[model samples]
Target: MRFFNTEGPVRPTDHYSLPPLERWDLNEILTFIEQKKYFLLHAPRQTGKTTCLLALMDHLNRTGLYRACYANIEGAQAAREDVERGMAIICSVLARSAQHYLQDSRLNNWVRADGALVPAGDRLFQLLEYWAAADARPAVLLLDEVDALVGDTLISLLRQVRAGYTQRPNGFPQTLILCGVRDLRDYRIHGSSERDPITGGSAFNIKAKSLRLDDFSAAEVRTLLLRHTAETGQVFTSEALDRVWDLTQGQPWLVNTLAYRACFELPEGRDRTRPITLALIDQAKEALILERVTHLDQLAYKLREPRVRHVIEPMLAGTALGDVPDDDIQYLLDLGLLRQGNGGLTIANPIYREVLPRTLAFTPQASLPQIYPTWLNADGSLNPTALLEAFLAFWRQHGEPLLRSAPYHEIAPHLVLMAFLHRVVNGGGTLEREYAIGMGRMDLCLRYGAVTLGMELKVWRDGAPDPLTEGLIQLDGYLAGLGLSSGWLVIFDRRADQPPMAERTASSTTVSPHGRSIELVRA
Candidate 1:
């Protein structure tokens, strides 16, 4: 029976998957190859780039039109800047893959070259030339993980590919496709032989086009899960399928992992007669996040990068991403950390949206003082008034020490607030967050039993007027959206001359333009 695949490439007989060619514009790719053009294909890691290349290679070779071969040259990354060692491994892998996939032994001729010595940089160029010459059909080379190679080794490979671009059809590979997590334009080749940092464009100026393999669409997500149902005689409830799309937004790996965990890992879920439910889907996602699954954990680690911080920090603060370069934005998008939304760039998926805030709130959450959840009523229901009083007292007692420990200076107050709330809602409730560039605030909606608390957090920066009026307007709109008659508006005084937390932190009730009562908290 077919099962959902969470690791490695998906095989049709074992895992449910969308047709590889259906995920891309095949006609556009074929036209590029037919015109003897070199191009790039890039996407987030594990989003099916390798699968597409393998399928494309098969299609081309089976058509009797081109001698196509797919190779993963990541084995060369271990050599780092050692150009000679890296290039040798890369060329050897290519030859082996060509023999395995195309059943072509001509890679032997390229590597051996009649015992003639080929220089490190020219190694790949010469190999391709020899392979094209020996093969009866035109050569098509698909090199996966091209960005994994770094330093002079990466430069050499790119230069070698560009070095042989003039030769076409029978002289060199008719089509060379570079596949990696980043577009060729984003490759900033450092430690080059030229003694200066160069870009992949300068190294391989012959690229004809670049294609990004996107995640499965909503419809495709349905088609994929239904295939498993068709094979195993199990069923996914309508809500379960929708929940998958909502949480993962059709991310290929995440979609598969959630389903696999729900159907295979959970004891109750294994019963084929029992339909998969949205609750099961949520449980699966929670498990994946809590375990720090390899894919999500790797993506989370990207937060520590300075380039990533430049993009994410501002988004977290609800401020403009000023001075962040376009390339950096594109790089984050390629990493699946960001996506193009109706307004502008946003976190890619609901899971990622949850991951960012929770991750930022991690340290504060752990170091929080042991205080019982004071917001619960006698009936174990959430009391927003009690929660506000408890937070005010906590801020007066522990805010200074906690703020000193926060990693980000700009968002320290926000982090501390969220960490406190996360502890309260860690069980028996849900906390939803929304922040964006130029929003000037972060909105949090805490849904506990029989109560939903909406709060808007704002910072009063140096030389700026009190944000009370502006915050009120923003909070009014926020409460309107939540369909609530009351919420909290928190204004953090960030001026260098501000008073101590004990003196500055206080709360008062106020009326909004929409006639909603708001608890205005200034700290």
Candidate 2:
């Protein structure tokens, strides 16, 4: 009775999996370790860094090449300032891990030499030295969740590891691998007095190489799903696989979560033998997003951090921040929040693109009832005039209220409008949204059966002139890209002179180049 695991480390006897070791390029990692080199291994949270490290440790230990052990140092994060307390926790965890893996009490004994754990700031290196001396074979150490330690404690840990690098293969651990959600180069240690403020100095430069574990590839995701089918005789339809890939973009946790939910949690007596379908996948996606599970919730919290804002705001505006630091972009990329595309940055996947704006608009009223409906006709056609009139009225009455209450106040007007549109057509239609930090425009495409409506939303500052002409051109281009003849240009006129709807003549319909028509609606 095996099942897909979406939680912590997968055990061999459990309904677990080991994504083919052959599929990953671990030779470089092995070579680095064999050469007694220290390095960093990082990727987005829950992307299997711990699993991979554990597997690698098993391989190394079983091959009789090295004595390997994995320990998480996150517990030391709280005792950051009290170096002594942090070191004691680190020593205790390392001892426990060694006792579990090596089945040898000697490793633990050495760590707790003379019935006393070494004091903070000194325990980690001392334990490493003792273990290297006590072990018959060279040792490989994997430090998981290294980034969880913050401020001075993190700096102390890194510095100690760097200090002990020279004694490797003899008095120190033969190889060290620091695993976390960020690469070492991106480490922004704040309370360190030894490093220069402007240019982060070399507090710890022992890293010989930095390896990033990437998301599952399309083929790999298929193989993972097929493994379950082979075991349980349950099948996944092709369209289901396509939808899963589209929604999760091969995020490992998401893929496993969806599969687990599909096979185990779906309503009973459904069509289980017909192979899962795209609609099922969509259902699971919606459920997960609505649940705001741990992974998604953690990512949402990061949105409030200034570093995330620096990258996301520009992408939302449809503009680029040319002078942005590489580390800032890299941090977001490592978090699975952004992806590299077209030689520039883009939302990592479609699900993120949809979730980012909606999540940013978190508020009780943002999810309020929509007085307007999404469909214009009974035949799944859009009624542009009705849609515009409803939006205009809604905007005039509650537009200010919604904007003022949005979580991301800067993008409140735009998101509130989208929320209104989403509520209206959510049942019968689909809205494809694309916006990123620093990008100046939010492009949206409304799909209603056979007809597609494209729109570009923008906001004008108080002193800036009207953006209708520019918005129309942009909307026309967007429409043409979608092979549509006409669309709407919705602008939030924040300028002081902008009058109410009744007094506003600027909000009207017009035709642009190549006979492309646009209705400029002001809120």
Index of the highest-lDDT prediction: 1
**Off by more than 4 A, model 2:** 12-20, 110-117, 186-188, 192-199, 268-270, 364-384, 425-430, 436-440, 447-452, 461-466, 480-486, 500-507, 512-517
Clashing residue pairs in candidate 1 (N, C-alpha, C atoms within 3 angstroms): none
Q: Each candidate's lDDT (Cα)?
A: 0.87, 0.77
Give candidate 1's root-mean-square deviation (CA, Å).
2.5
**For residues 314-399, what per-residue lDDT tens digits would candidate 2 score against the true structure?**
67766666677777788899898888877577888777787777677657245555575643777657777777777777776677
Off by over 4 Å in 1: 105-116, 186-188, 192-196, 199-201, 377-379
RMSD of each: 2.5, 3.4
Candidate 1 structure quality by residue, lDDT tens digits, 99-197: 798677778666867413988878788888888888679999999999888887987887778778888787999999999998766456866342256
Clash statistics: count for each candidate: 0, 22
Give me candidate 1's TM-score against the actual structure. 0.93
lDDT of 1 at 302: 87
